[model samples]
Target: MVVQTESFVMLSIVLFVLGAMGVLLRRNAIMVFMSIELMLNAANLALVAFARYWGNETGQLFVFFVITVAAAEVAVGLALIVAIFRSKRSINIDELHEMKG
Candidate 1:
């Protein structure tokens, strides 16, 4: 059975909203990072759905680039989080804001 693009888009929207809420409501750095990744995945899902619906490769190609950038972001972001956790012994966002040099 062929899946409709609207369904995919709807699911993507739900995921994006959940990610946004997570980002806004979570105080843990790792949780916030995960939420950002979730948002990215949601966007990628929509892009792939649109690409499939339109019979074009452009959206899919864009999604590929986005995924690549997201990977790099994950690497760098995790490294920073680790470093901060090592120095501060905590990963709380509110505490992190107090780290102004």
Candidate 2:
């Protein structure tokens, strides 16, 4: 069973758009961070689809690097979120901006 590249690309686009909406519409810092991760995953999906269609290993290799970076991003992002929540007792972005010095 062969899947078409267009299908994967379309799914990626939909996921990316949903992620963008989540980032824009949600006021919670954690939600925005999750949406950003979703966007990254969508891009990774597109990259893998293109690599498979082109019969090349480059995109797959690039995905490994992306995943590595994403892992680091997750660690740092979650740590920040935890710290913010501890200090503010809230993860609302609007409330965070009031902390401007």
Candidate 3:
């Protein structure tokens, strides 16, 4: 059985909304980062679906670039989070008020 394009888009939207809510509601740095990743993945899903629907590779190509950037972001972001946790002994966003390092 074939899936509908609208259904795919709706699912993608649902995932993106959930991720956005997670980012807005969660206070932990790691949680916020994960939520952002989820949102990015949701966008990728929509892009793939639309690419398939339109019979083109442009969206897919964009997804590849997104994935690459996401990979780099994950590496750099986790490092920063780890460093912050090491120095501050916490990962809560509201607690991180100091900028001088």
Candidate 4:
């Protein structure tokens, strides 16, 4: 039997939920950031799937832009994390309170 778009959407939803849970439950800053990225990727997958199903290019174009932004975010974020690690010697969110100032 052929798979349906609904099934794909459901899978994406599950992935998004898992990512959200991971972000909420993890204390490590890197793991939390990775979870957020996973959530973004899940949304991108759903958007592309929906675009294909509806015969529209806009959603796919939006996903491309989102991916570009995500890449930039990852680059900048990693740089910041590296700086923080050098100063703090740890990547735990709890130890990052000094970043507020």
Best by TM-score: 1
Worst 10 residues of 4 by lDDT: 92-101
Q: For model 1, which pairs clash?
A: none
lDDT of 3 by residue, 1-101 (tens): 19988898999999999999999999999999999999999999999999999999999999999999999999999999999999999999989877856
Q: How many steric clashes between backbone atoms does each model show?
A: 0, 0, 0, 0
lDDT of 1 by residue, 1-101 (tens): 28899999999999999999999999999999999999999999999999999999999999999999999999999999999999999999888675567
Candidate 2 residues 9-92, lDDT tens each? 999999999999999999988899999999989999999999999999999998898899999999999999899889989889
| Candidate 3 segments exceeding 4 Å error | 99-101
TM-score of each: 0.92, 0.90, 0.91, 0.89
- Order of candidate numbers by TM-score, starting with the best: 1, 3, 2, 4
Q: What shift in Å separates residue 32 of candidate 1 from its native position after superposition? A: 0.4
User: Which stretches of model 1 miss by more than 4 angstroms?
Assistant: 99-101
**lDDT head-to-head 1 vs 4, winner:** 1
Hey, what RMSD does candidate 2 come out at? 2.0
Go through the candidates in order and give the C-alpha RMSD of each one to the true structure: 2.0, 2.0, 2.6, 2.2
lDDT score of residue 22 within candidate 3: 92
Tell me the deviation in Å of residue 54 in model 2: 1.1
